[model samples]
Structure formats: structure tokens, C-alpha cells
Target chain A: MRLGKRRATPLPELNMTPMIDVVFQLLIFFMLVPHMTRVNKELLELPKLSGTEDQQESAITINITRDGQIIVTNEPRTVAGVVEMVSEEIRRLGGDRSRVKVLVRADHRGTSRMVNQVVSALAKLGVHQIRVGVEVPSR
Target chain B: MRLTSRGVQRDRKIELAMTSMIDMTFLLLIFFMTTGGFMTIERDLDSAIKERPSGRAASSDLEPAIVEITRVGSGYVYRVGSRELTTARELTDLLRKFPNKIDGAYVRVSDGAPFEMAAAAIQSCKDARFLSVAYVPID
Candidate 1:
């Protein structure tokens, strides 16, 4: 007598429910993670501009570069030279330094620290009313 | 008691490995420890020009010595009384004198000039120890 033949069965379909659940969980986990950042708050402070035309004849304008170069009245000057020249100018202006106003125009790329060096130096001379210049594009 | 060879049998059990779990925990711990703090840069008041209040007008008596900085090709052209300066030192020399001896020193900066040039000018004012600085924005 011949042995009975063994029966073959078809493969069962895969269940994708667990895989979808895992993917959704991972998405939620990543969304909850906080981003890291360092912000500068002091740079946001804006100075007041009196813009009085009457003082126009009394203000001194100073321009700055990213690398800390200075240009004044269409002339180029070194850091020390600028100080010396300003001192002499103050002395010559009837020896009244208080009447001298400084207007500083610096690039956006330059750090506040770089700008402060100029302010501190001016402060030592007992002059006040520092005006900073900003460029607003014409509408 | 001694076991008979025919009656003795070996059994093996499966368990999860803990090395991966330890490594993951260490990674997470290091990540949190190294990146939890943020730095805030303080605003230096001396570097900023104050914002003028609304509805304020310019002084009519002022005669501004307008020093216009025009964008020339890739660089900038500094002009004072129709004069141009080629060196950084020259700019400082002119700024040093400023409105002290002159009636009005108008500082008009171009939008295209390198920031360093502008900063140097401001530094010159600081060196001269002038506190009253005014900045004019160009179109």
C-alpha cells in the first residue's frame, strides 16, 4: 500500500498594523524634541535720533567698516590718528568739545563690541549725545 | 548524586542582550549634558543710536556739512567739498577736525561702502572724544 500524500498549504498575508504604529510613534518623538539656539538681545536695541536740523552744523559723522576701518569727511585715517585728529579738531573748535556731536554709521555685519570701542573712546572726552546711523530703503 | 548519561540533558534559554541599551543610555546622557545652556549677548547702549520720537522736526538753523559717500563701482567714493580720499588715514584726518572748526559737518554714507570704512570714521570721532555724533542715512 502506498503512503498517503502530504498536503501543502499557501503562505499567510503579512500584517502591517504594527509597522504603521511604530512609524507614527517615532514621528511624534522627533516633533517633541527642542531645538538649540543662541540669541543676541542687545543687538536689537535701537537708539533715538533727534534729527534736529538745527544741530546739523554741530554733529560730527563717522563711518565704519567690517574690519574696523574709519572714513571721515572723505578722508581715510588710522585708529590712533582718528583720535589725535579729533582731539585737535575739538581744541580748534573754540576749545569747546561738548559742542561736538559724533554720528556713527557702522555695517550690519560688525558686532556691537566693535562699535562700543568707538563710543567708550568718545565718552572719555566728556562729549555726549551719540547718534547712530541706519539706512532705510526708500519705499 | 551522580547522574546517569542516559538520564542527563542540557537546557539552553534565550535572553536579550543589554550592551545596546547601555550604549544608548550613555549617548542620550551625553547629549543632554553637553547642550543645555544658551548665551545671551547684552546690548551695549553706547553703540546704539536712539530712535527719535514721532512728530519731531529738524532744526532750521543748522547748516549741515554734508559728506556724501557714493557707491563707485565695487568700492565707495568719499567726498567732502568736492575732494576725494584714497587712503584710510586721510579719512581719519578729515574726521578728526569734524564740525569743531567747521560750521556744519554732514556725514552722508553710501549704501555700498564696506562696513570697515564706516566704522573707522566712527572710531576717529571717538578718538577725538566727540560725544555729539549725528548720522545721516542715504537713499
Candidate 2:
């Protein structure tokens, strides 16, 4: 009876060391993954508009800075270079340019000429529909 | 002897209270997860670039409404055909009153015009309920 009473008296305590380790690992992962994925996105002051649609996944992202610089996949490219890169991307998608979706994130303070040049190049490649990134105005 | 035994028992009871630490860690994890999802809350504005035949113009009545955006010193000027406007709000109101709404609208952005003006022009066209908005690059 004494042995049974002693066994019941000791409550089971959960070992939190392993759990804490796993939680820490997850915290680190969540912290690092976003930074890694955002490497391709250049920091720019995007245009704000109230009538905007939800952004969808795109096959390519072209960033235009205030100085009229264009960056694609984290590499700066000229208008012609951007055209070439987009064409290559289209070819990789089984030579179907229509299947390719392009996202253009242009700085609000940048000249329209840069965005226009990029759009013209994309148009020449038969990629008509393009997504322009903008910030949703907070009401 | 009794005092020594009590001290030993007290030392055993003074464990690192991991409950609060675990709770805080979980709270941080939840916070990071929720905020990380919002890091990229950018929306999209869809624009189309149609390839017109080399030397063909649509009929006069079938032409798309053109909104010309030009930079004027420190400010910008928005022109939808002959009517000139200083603000995007006025542009939206004018486009809303336009009669022919089927052909959509063409936003012609000049070289030096800022991108915000162009985006605003497009947004105005959308706010007016145009079926399509085309970005026209003027060199």
C-alpha cells in the first residue's frame, strides 16, 4: 500500500526543454525565410490606390526605381536586357508567352518613361496583361 | 540537522519557472507568423498593352479615350483629350461623365511625368468603370 501511495504521490512533469528547442527553431526559421524570399524585391515607394486588386503569383517581377533603373530577379537590366530576359522566361514556359505573367513594381516618384519602356518591351514580346504593384490606401 | 534538510528541500523547489518563458515564446511565435504574412500586402493594378498593327488606326468612334499625363514644373497636368485637369479626383469625375465607355481608356504617360500620376490616371479610368485600361508609353 505504501509503495502504491508513493508512486501516486509523484506527479508527472512535462519535459519542456525539447519543446522549447523546437519552438526556437521554428522562430528562427520564420524570421529568416521572409528575408530570403524578399531579396528579389527592391525597396521602393509604390503607388497607393484605393481601387486595387489582390496581387497574384507572377512568373517574373520587374522593379523600376526612382532613378529609372530596372531590376529583374535581383539583377539590374536595361530595357533591351529586360526584353531578352522576359523572352527567355517565356521560352522556358514551353514557348508560350501568353502563359507568362509579369509583375511590374515601379516607384511612385519615378518617371513614367521607365515604366512605359518596360511595358513596351513586354508588349513587343506578346505579354499583354501585366500586374502593376501598388499599396492599398488605408482608409 | 533539520535546518540543513530544509535548505536542501528549498533548493530543489527553486526551479526555473519555464511556464512563463514557454508562454512568452509561443506568443512571440504567433506574433511573427501573423505579422510575416502581412509583410507583403501589396495589391495589384492590372494594365494591358495591346499590339496594334504597324500602320492601322481604329475608326474614329471606336478609338479608346486617351488620358495624357504630362509633367508641368513641380506639379503635373492630366489631359483627357482636350479637357485638362490638375488633380486625379477631377480626372475621375470627368471620365465618369464620358459617353462612350465601351472602348475603355488609354493612359498616355509622357517621358518626365512621375509614375504616381500615371497610376492615378489608370486608377481614375478604373474608377470610371472602364472595361479595360491600357498603358501607352510616349517617348
Best by TM-score: 2
Question: Ten-residue segment with the worst summed lDDT in candidate 2 chain A?
Answer: A1-10
Please give the lDDT score at residue A92 for candidate 1: 76
All models, DockQ values? 0.05, 0.41
Alpha carbon lDDT of residue B62, candidate 2? 26
The per-candidate TM-score of the B chain, in the order shown, comes to: 0.44, 0.66
lDDT of 2: 0.78
The CAPRI category of model 2 is acceptable
Model 1 residue B10 CA deviation (Å) reads 99
Question: C-alpha displacement of B51 in model 1, angstroms?
Answer: 20
lDDT of 2 by residue, B1-139 (tens): 1222344334443245587577767877787888765564588888887544222224343245788786667777987655679999998998888787877788877778989988898899989988888887776
Show where candidate 1 strays beyond 4 Å: A1-59, B1-139
Locate the minimum summed-lDDT window of 10 residues in model 1 chain B: B39-48
TM-score of candidate 2 against the unseen true structure: 0.79
Q: Model 2 residue B82 lDDT?
A: 56
